[model samples]
Target: MNSKDFTAGLAELRGLRDEIKTLRKQLAKLETARDKQITALAAYEKAKAERIAPAAGVSVADVVALAPTLAPPAPPQPQEEPAPTPQAATNAAGRPEPTGVPAPDLRRAPGKPAATGTAPDTTITGGSDAPPAVGTPSSHPGPGRQPTTTPAADGEQPEQVRELPSIPPGQDGDTWFTATPNLTSTRPNFTQQPRQMAFLDATTGVLVHRDTTTRLNLGTGSVADILIAVYATVPATVERIYITAGDPWHRDAERYPFLRDAVAAWLNGPLPDGWKIESTRGRDRLAGHLVHPRNPVGRWQRGDQHTEIRSVGEWFDPDGATPATVRDAFVLLWRALHRHWPDVTLMGSPSQTGRDLWSRTIPTKAGAKWADGYPVMSEEIRGLLHATAGQGRTELITPPKVPDRLPQLIELDRTFAYAKHTWASGVGIPRRITAAAFAALSEKDQINALFAPSHWHIRVTIPHDWNHVGLLPAPAAGDRTWHYPAEPGRTFTTWAGGAEVNLALRNPHTPWKVEILDGLLWEAGSPLREWSTRLKDAWASLRAIAATHGDPKQRTAAHLASRAVRAILLYGIGAFAQRPRITTGTVPTGAEHDIPTGAQIIGTDGHTITWQRDTGFARDPYAHPEWAAGVWSAARAALLSTKMREDNLFVGALHLPPGSVVAFRTDAIYTTTDPAWPYHGHPGDYLKKGHLPGPVTGPRTEDELLSLQTLGRAHLAEEQEHHR
Candidate 1:
């Protein structure tokens, strides 16, 4: 609109046009420099590829071929020479051309038959017949490529073929291409070989090689032979081969000297690639280590059935072989192995050997001789001997000499008899006496003397029925019909109201009664004779004391004297009778009708008496001389004999006819009268009998008799009152 605005606008447009012209020239220069840089980069890459390809064991063409961009495109041929079949593309050799790159074939599944004689198609994006890569994202199907609908064959399981990524040339200053040949076609073919086998002899600990044609006994073969034989025999396909060493292999080392070395060599030597060799000792070896082998490769069948081989060694015969033998064999094997290869891996535990193999392998040093002898005498024997002798060590033992004197002989005989009896009875005899006996008698004498009887027998009479006898004397004429004959030679019989009475006799007469006559004769020569004389003197003394006291009743004096006599006799006879005696001996008839040398006269007081030719008695009559004298003195003062006679006379008087004289004798009197005869007619008759003088109590034991005597002397008045 204005002249000045139009002129300014035109000046600005002219300046702008000049600036645009200069920018166009600059852009053209930049484009020309960019082109030059691209052309120079291509030429530099080609020169680098050529320089390094030789060192990489590859040609420059190969390097260029690896990179598609750098490779020259092939010129199109007249669609005439139809695309070469995989078979037709072979080089001068019959083998097909190697595919420089691995390519997936989608038309045929993996692991399937590659159309007979045709190589696997590896052209991924080249010819019209090339199939599309699997899993490649695409919308339209290419020409001549129909969608595959038929399911793959049963054996046509496909495997994904991964193509290794291409490396750029000069990367890491190296250009290398790894050719992945199809393993299915390139793997070397192998024909299977027959299995070569060998067995270990269980009995001999030797290896026996076997084949279809012949069997060879390789007893104690060299280590090398064993290794080669085993290695060559087993199949190449076998990853692990096991050799079993039997028990004998471990046990008899002398027989199997090379077994250990052989096994070691076999294990340590080189094997085929991907191959291994393993071995087993035997069941014993496994059991010792507590290892159980699984999937045994070798086994014998019962008939024709396939069975696993559990053990390679001997067939174990439990009945014929000992476990100890087998175990010993294992120990030997272990020791051998441990000595050679200390770190060898064993199948079974070595702990079962129960010994430190390594420690045992060390040689032992020689030591001083400790002992050498058959039936060697040990410290225990010495100690035992020392213990036996009370003081000194016993260097030697000898049998004691037989006793000579009659007294000594009798004592030895008695002691031996007592020991034997005690042993037989299982009752413990005083050790002091037994030891003395053993010391006195020789071993032979001891054995012979044991058969002799040493027990005592005392004939004692008590009321047949205990209830009939009370603390009182029976009436003289209460019932005459109850009376029975009591003569020594007569057999007592009785009747009640014309019915024969079956009276129970406490002391039945036997043929042994005749022995009493012999006892009486023996008593004359024994200390009992002296005891009887002393008793009579004590009685006389009691009587004299009673007379001086002005006791008119001679019965009381006689009773007291009789009591003293009885007391003396009881105590002395008891002491005499308790002596050990030999009861077994021949009873000489005529000239030697006297008591047998060691025959015993057993008393009723549980004592025994044996005649000693020298001493009159086996044991001393007065073992307690002072006590005997005191007893005599006390009897004299108390008039014990008189009291005893008086009580006896009183009892006799009560039993005899009313005016008849009843004598009290100091001599021992054997009676056959039954004290229970009168009371037996009626059960309650004993209770009706009134209290009588002197309690009618019978001592059941020797101790009871002593107690009664003591009580009678101490409390005569109380006893008398109770009796009354």
Candidate 2:
């Protein structure tokens, strides 16, 4: 067999082995859980019975009837593994307690006052005939038991009952369980962290730290304790130490004495052969021996398994990211990172969304306070390190379960990734942008474009002259400046035709202008034409997926995200067409702009066009218009307004009063005689207020126009200001 086949077979075998191990452990957990339930229920039956020990002839129906009283409402849990709740857990007396964990419960974290609850349960054994003696310990201690320090049960498999610290109750019993964010993570298994996590792998003894916010490896050890743990053993994978910046030896030395000392030792210690992280001048500082950006200094090496220390902090700038955006951005980034690196460790954070969403409720008795739940790393996370911990499994990964209520956002992320991959370079991750994703791409692109200029940054003018029309429903008087409404006989993009097929909305005072020069830029095979079609197709697929199973809210988010695509495809190219390839603005203030080809703009007077051609003759800059102002603007004008207005790209066309027009906004026509389209009642992108007008697709009399002239004049001023 070939080497490739052998490698593939070997990988499959190893994966199967891990899968078998995971399955066996999970089965063992199920058995333990089932045993705990059986134990609790049996004890409960005996306790509730007043007469002789009630274990005789108890049927299944009676036990089933009692379950609903303590069981938490089951929602659509992703993994189908229902998490054990306090009500379902086997307490010290080994019975399910409704109030909370008892004082003797060992699981409560140190210093936390044990909750006041019912007496510890007695273990029921020998066919539930009688309870165990008072001091006897139950087989299963349930959820709140002191966390087992042993990594695996009997040292055979990983821990089954992971330490998932639940909400510490208030005087009112922590009534805020529903307020939990129900967050989605980029990590598979939908793992979420209640707080940032750091760990020393149970088996490997290798210390690891991960930043959940961005899913990147934060520096392993900066805290003195963490440093001691990292070097406690010269780990197989440890080669270089990466610091956030040069010489962490200044103020940091005092803050992290242990780390500083380690650095000093490594510096003064004899260097290993093939050691790296060189420096000449700053030997006094680790910066001289070590780093910048991510200072990587070799700790040790075993051919091919180089152990290096990585300082991974400076990259995550949380300045602009807020709690809200960070949450949304997490959903977006997680999807991208997960598909790229599935099977990576999942992290958890105490949910921030709960307190914020229910913040105003705090003043009332039922309010949620800011106390975070005790967070424990998810089993998915623990499993990650367990499988490869001491084996130096430092690479990242994620699992496949999606968060509840976040399917739509996840889909948007998937679509965005597909779109990003369309760029010349396939890497679509935004390394620079942080702190939460904005609902609008315009905001994100504007903020993150600093990494490099994108097509979104290009700007050019689309010149045009004002053209008049003969009023509503009547075709404009100029050279085809406006398109009359047509049939909704549109396909793919043109839904219900007419204004719906293109950009033209039924605005009362919105006049149609005709292009004076150049061919249609959005005609078949052209960039704009291809782009709009592609966007329409992409959006159509997304819309179908959303409508079939998604809710209105998802559809709304999908539409908002689509604007970024439109900006890239439609507007991005529009910016390109404004200037031909060879374009030069006037070097001097008064000089004219110059274009080498395609619809060149030429004018002698400075005031009329303000730019002129400076080719050959060294004319005064102030005396000439830009030398290359040519046909590009005219083409741009055609694409931007003239042809585009008639292109039929409406977002749910409104029914306008055919004969007598009123006013209009992007989609809604305002004819109520009070505030019109330009006058907004709210400060958002979309707002609708008008009732449907009569189905009249003809012209009104000049007398009707006369009465509306004043309103028209007022609207015209607002429209200009709004656009400006």
Q: How far does residue 406 in candidate 2 sit from its true spot (Å)? A: 43
For candidate 1, the 10 contiguous residues with the lowest summed lDDT are 514-523
lDDT of candidate model 2 versus the reference: 0.25
Q: Against the unseen true structure, what C-alpha lDDT does each candidate score?
A: 0.24, 0.25
Give per-candidate clash totals.
25, 77
- lDDT of each residue in 1-724, candidate 2, tens digit only: 9999999999999899778767876876886666455547645543331121135233222232223222222222345445554423332234432222111111111221101000112100011211111222223222222211122111322122222112222312112212113321111223232223233321222333333222122242232322444444434333333232333333234433345333433332333344433332221112222312222232333344333343322112222222223233334333322342342222221111211211212122111111222122222222221221111001100111111111110000011211211111101111111111111113223122211211110001111121211111211122322222221211000011111111121112231211110000110111122223344454444445345635544444343323323333322222211121222121222443433333333222222221223233111111101000111111111111221112222111122222222322122222322222232111111223222222322114334323343344455556557999
Residues 586-688 of candidate 1 have per-residue lDDT tens digits of 1222324465554442211112121222223222211222112222211211110111121222111123222111111111111112232222211011111
Where's the lowest-lDDT run of ten residues in candidate 2?
A: 515-524
